[model samples]
Target: MSAALGLLAVIVLTAATGYFVAQEFAYVAADRAALEQAAARGDASARRAAKVIGRLSFMLSGAQLGITMTTLVVGFIAKPALAGLIQPLLDAAGIPEGATGAIALAAGFVLATLIQMLLGELFPKNLALARAESLARALASSTLVYLTVAGPLIRLFDRAATRLLRTVGVEPVEELHSGATLEELGDIIGKSQSSGHLPADLSGLLDRALSFGDLTADEVMVPRPQVSTLPSTAPAADLVALIRETGHSAYPVYDGEVDDVIGVAGVREVADDALDPATPVGRIARPALLVPGSQPLYGVIERMRESGEEFACVVDEYGGLAGILTFEDVAEELVGEIADETDAREDAPTTGPDGSWLVDAGMRIDEVVRLTGLDLPEGDAYDTLGGLVMAELRRLPCPGDRLTVALDGASGHGEPDGASGHAELEVVSVARRVAEKIRIRTAAAPAPADRPEISDPPCAAPRPEEASWTR
Candidate 1:
C-alpha cells in the first residue's frame, strides 16, 4: 500500500483502539445507580449503557479484543509506512547506502508506539474515568453494535476464562461489584483522611453517617443508671425539681419501679393553674412512647417521628426500661456532640497539665478512637470509653484507675494496620459508682505525655450501680 494510505489506516486504527479503551473504562467506572436513575427518566442512551454494564465480563472481553486487534493492525500498517517515508529523509540528510533503512525502521517504531499509547491509551482512559457517565451513555449505542458483531468470539473467550476461573475455585459474576461494605468504606475514608485527601471533620462525619444505620437504640442511649426518673406517685413539685435541676424538659414517670415506666411528663405539664404542688406527677404525664433496645436507629427515628415523641423509652427483653433515647442522642450520633447553653464547658474534654486528655468517661468509643488514634477493641457489649474501661476492668472504675490496651493501628480512622502501639486509660474520677471522668494517654498521639501503663487489663463482673446522672 502507498505510504499515504497506510498512514491514514494507522490513524484510523489508533482511533479505533482509543474507542475501545474509552468504552471499557467508561462502562466500568460509570455509577450504576446514576445510570439507572437516568434510564428511569427516559434517557435511551443511558438505558443502553445500563444494559452494557449488566454483562460486564462479556463487554470487557469484547473491548479488550478490539483494543488488541486495532493496536496490532496499527503497528503492522504504520511501521513499514513510517519506514518508507523516513528513508528518503535519512538519505537526504546523509546519503547513506545501508544505514537509512535500519535508522528509519527504529525511528518509525518508536513514533508509532508513542502515538498509540498517548492518544489511544492513557488520554482516553483518563477522560473516560473522569466523565464516565456521560461517555458511557454517548458511546453505548456504538459499543452495542460492536459487541453484537463480536458476540460469538467474545462469548468463546469469556467461557474459556470462566472455565479457568472455576478450575481455581473462582466464580465469575456477570456484573462488576458496586457498593462497598461499611468496614471497607471506613478503610478508604481512613486512608483519605491520613493522606489529607479528605478533611478530618468532614471525613469523620461521613464515616459516622455511613455506620449510623447499623446502630441500635441500645448502642446510643443513656444507660438506665444514668437516666433520671420519677415514681408515678411522686408529687408535682418533685417532678418540677428534677426538671429544673437537670435542665431537661422531660422525665419518665414510672409505676413502682424504673422498669415499669408508665408515662412521660414535660415542663409544659407544669404550667397548669388548677394543679397543686401536692398533686401526683403521673396525673399530668402524657402516654410514654416505648421502643425495643434492639431496634435500629432509623426505625427508632421513624417511630419517634410518627408518634410525635421527641424521645423514646428503650425496654429490654423482659419489658424493663434499659435507657432513654432522645433525638439529641440520634443527632449526636451523626454530628458528634451537640452542646447547648445548659451544658457545662468544664464537662468537655480538656488537656491536662501533663498532656493527658481529661475526658468524660461516658464519651462514645468512636470519639475516643478519633482522639487518641488508638485501636481500643470494640464489641456489642459497650459503646463508650467508660463502658470499655468497665468492660476491661470487669467492674466500675474508681479514682486513679489505670489500664493499658494494645493498639491495632495508629491511623485512628481506618482498618487495623500492622503498625503497633498502646494506650493508657486512667480513671480520674468516679461519681455515684460511674466512671464519670478519665485521663487518656497514648503512644504516638499528640495530646498527652507518657503515663503509667497497665497491660491487657483483667475485667471484673459488672455490678449494680447506685446512680447519679440525669438527662
Candidate 2:
C-alpha cells in the first residue's frame, strides 16, 4: 500500500479498536435502571443502550471480535509501513542496508504496540468507565449495527463459551444481575455519602430502609418489662389517666397475666362523657393482633395492615408476651424517631475526656459502631450495645456491674479520641429491669472504691414516655 493509504488505514483500524474497548466497558458499567428511565422519557438512544445491555454476552462477544480484528489489521498495516518509513532514515544515517530492515522491524513493533495499548486500549476504557451512561447512549446504535454484521461469529463464540462453562458446572448468564444486593446497596450508599454525592440524611434513610426488613419482631419491639398494662377488670376510665401520663393511643388489656392478653383497647373508644367509668376494659377491648417474636418485621407489618390494628403483641415461642410492636417502631426504623409534642427524645450519647461514652442502652449496635468506631460483633440474638453487654455478662446487670474484656480494633473514633485496647463495660444505670445506661471505655473496670459517683439516671435525662408499652 502507498505510505499515505497505509497510515490512514492504521488510524481507522486504531479507531475501531478504541470503539470496541469503549463499548465493552460502557455496556458493563451503564446502569440499566437509569437507561430504562430515560427510555421511558422517550430517549431513543437510551432505549438502544438498554437493548445492548440486555444481551450483554452476545454484545461483549462482538466487542471482543471487533477488537481482535482491528488490532490484527492495525499490526499488519502499521508495522510494515513503520519499517518502510524508518529504513530510509537508517540509510541516511550511514547504517548498513543489511542491518536496516531488522532494526526497523523491531523499532516498528515497539511503536505499533505502544500506539495500540495507550490509544486503542487504556484511554477508551477509562473514558468509558468514567462516563458509562453517556458513552453507552452515544455509541449504542453503532454497536448494535456492528453486532448485526458480526452476528454469526459472535453467536458461535457465545455458544462455545456457554457449553464450556456448563462442562465446568457453571451457567453462563446473558447479563449481570440488574439489581444490587442489599449489602452492595449499603456499600454504594456509604461510598456516595463519603464522596458527598449523596446527602447525609438521605444516606441514613436509605441505609435504614435496606436493613429494616432484617429486623424481626424481637429486634424491633419494646421489651415486655417496659410494658404498661391494665388489669382487664380495671375501669375503662383509667385509660384516660394512663393516656395523660404516657400519651400512647392504645394499650393491651390482659385478663390476668400479660401473656394472656384478651384484647387491645384504644383511648379514643372511651372518651364519652356519659359512659360508665366502671365498664370493664376487657369488655370494651377489641380483638388483639398476635405475632410471633421470630416473625419477620415485614410479616408483622402485613398482619397489622391486614387486620387494621395499630399494635401487635409479639409473643415468644413459649407463648409468653415478648413485647408490643407499634407502627411508630415500624416508621421509625426508616424515618427515625417519630417524637411528638409529648415525647421526650433520648439524649445523644455523651463522650468523656478519657474516651469513655455514656451511651443509651437503646442505641443500635450499628450506631454505636459509627459513634465510637468499636468493632463489636453483631449477634442474631440481639441488636443493641445493651444486648452485647448482657451477652458478655450472661445475666441481668445492676448498677456498678462490671464486665471487663479485651476488644480488638482501633479506637481513635476517627477523631482525636483515645486509644483502643482493653474495654470495660459497666452498667451505670438500670431501669424497667434492663440496663438503661452503659459506661464504655478503654480501661479496667473501676474498683467500687474508684467508682465515680453516678446518678441513677446518669445525666438527669428525662425518661422517654414511649418506653411505656402503651403499645
Best by lDDT: 1
How far residue 173's Cα lies from its native spot in candidate 1, in Å, is: 2.5
Could you give candidate 2's per-residue lDDT for residues 153-220 as a string of tens digits?
88888889899999999987786677778889888888888788999899878988988878889888
TM-score of each: 0.75, 0.87
Pull out the clashing pairs in model 2.
none
Candidate 2 lDDT for residue 163:
96
Q: On a 0 to 1 TM-score scale, where does candidate 2 land against the true structure?
A: 0.87
Over 4 Å off in model 1, which ranges? 1-11, 30-58, 72-119, 126-141, 148-171, 184-201, 317-319, 345-348, 411-420, 444-471
| Residue pairs with backbone atoms closer than 3 Å in model 1 (clashes) | 355-448, 393-459, 393-460, 394-459, 394-460
State the weakest 10-residue window (summed lDDT) of model 2. 462-471
Give the lDDT of residue 216 in candidate 2.
Answer: 87
RMSD of each: 6.2, 5.1
**Positional deviation of residue 155's Cα in model 2 after best superposition, in angstroms:** 1.0
